[model samples]
Target: MKKFPLLALAFCLATPAFAQSTQTTADLANTVKYRHAYQSMTKLPDWVAKATAVSVPAETLKLDGKSYLVGHLCKPHDCGDHQLDIVFSEDGKAVWGLLSRRYGKTLYQMPLGEPNTETLAALTASYHKNNPDDLAK
Candidate 1:
């Protein structure tokens, strides 16, 4: 597909070993970059800013011509215990998308489309496992 190159660019900008990073954000999951954006309190569409929030960068991905950060997001009251898919623009200045599953628990990974429940569950487990510091909090 014509979108493949943009995906590749996202991968490269994020990391070469990104794919092998347990299919998760891993060490970079809840890093400063993610925290800064979270602290920035940006929201997508009708989504409101939660009083408590944390983001784990799953990977850098792309949509259309813009590079975006794909990650697991958690909001104490809103998202509860389940991790949700959240997308941020490359500059970390805006929320590109938020797969809150307001209709269902489905998560959209962009370019590739929505992932099945099983895959999304595994990704969430990996996210918690990879980012223990956050889990402890």
Candidate 2:
């Protein structure tokens, strides 16, 4: 019976490592699964695919008492003018994005409509956090 308690403690310690194994931008970028998922949610731009080739991992963002993972992608040479910040649910089941163009002045939410407060908050926060300079513009 004492061994059972030790086993439970071990499992608890290992759980976080497993959770951290969630895929990052670099891991999911080239996969058809991610592309299809995003496309199913909204129109996937041609530049988006190209941007993924230069993808980078991003810090997670917390909003409305929920946590989300942010992914950064940008046009290779023209990054200053075109960029994308994708926000994925912790489980990666849901996805949304903020596309920034013309030096981050123009913004568009994916799915072609105004987003609810939480979503707009998450996407905007993720984008600005990843591109701090854009916040000043």
Candidate 3:
């Protein structure tokens, strides 16, 4: 009877480790796919210039005490303006997508993806749907 409680406690602790391992595999695969897509599309117009000018440094940090990789994208001319700080899992799966503004105004958190014409168009439509304020005047 007492032994049952101890056994259950041990199982509970072990379950999280098992779950993390499985999740890591899926995260790794997704990261690889995303990276491949980004690399392939980096040469295309509209994105090519910006992608080339932007630098994404690799760093590890803790968010809510959980470790994550920080990938940054800076603006072309003014590196401090409208910077994007993308948080990814250790395996490179994006966990949090945020747009940081140096001007103290909130910017929309747009989805990140490769610059394929079709993919970009689809993402733009989705972004507009989610954030109507981004529409041009």
Best by TM-score: 2
lDDT of 1 by residue, 81-103 (tens): 33455555678665533344333
Worst 10 residues of 1 by lDDT: 103-112
Q: How does model 1 fare in lDDT?
A: 0.51
Q: Which ten residues in a row have the lowest lDDT in candidate 3?
A: 42-51
Q: TM-score per candidate, in order?
A: 0.29, 0.52, 0.33
Comparison by lDDT, 1 against 3, better one: 3
* Rank list by lDDT: 2, 3, 1
lDDT (0 to 1) per candidate: 0.51, 0.70, 0.52
**Worst lDDT window (10 residues) for model 2?**
103-112
Top-scoring candidate (lDDT): 2
Between candidates 1 and 2, the TM-score winner: 2
Candidate 1 residue-wise lDDT at 108:
34
Mind giving the per-residue lDDT tens digits that candidate 2 earns over 15-132? 9878865688767754787877765655555778545546777777777778988777777777767777777788867777777777346664443234567777766776676678
TM-score of 2: 0.52
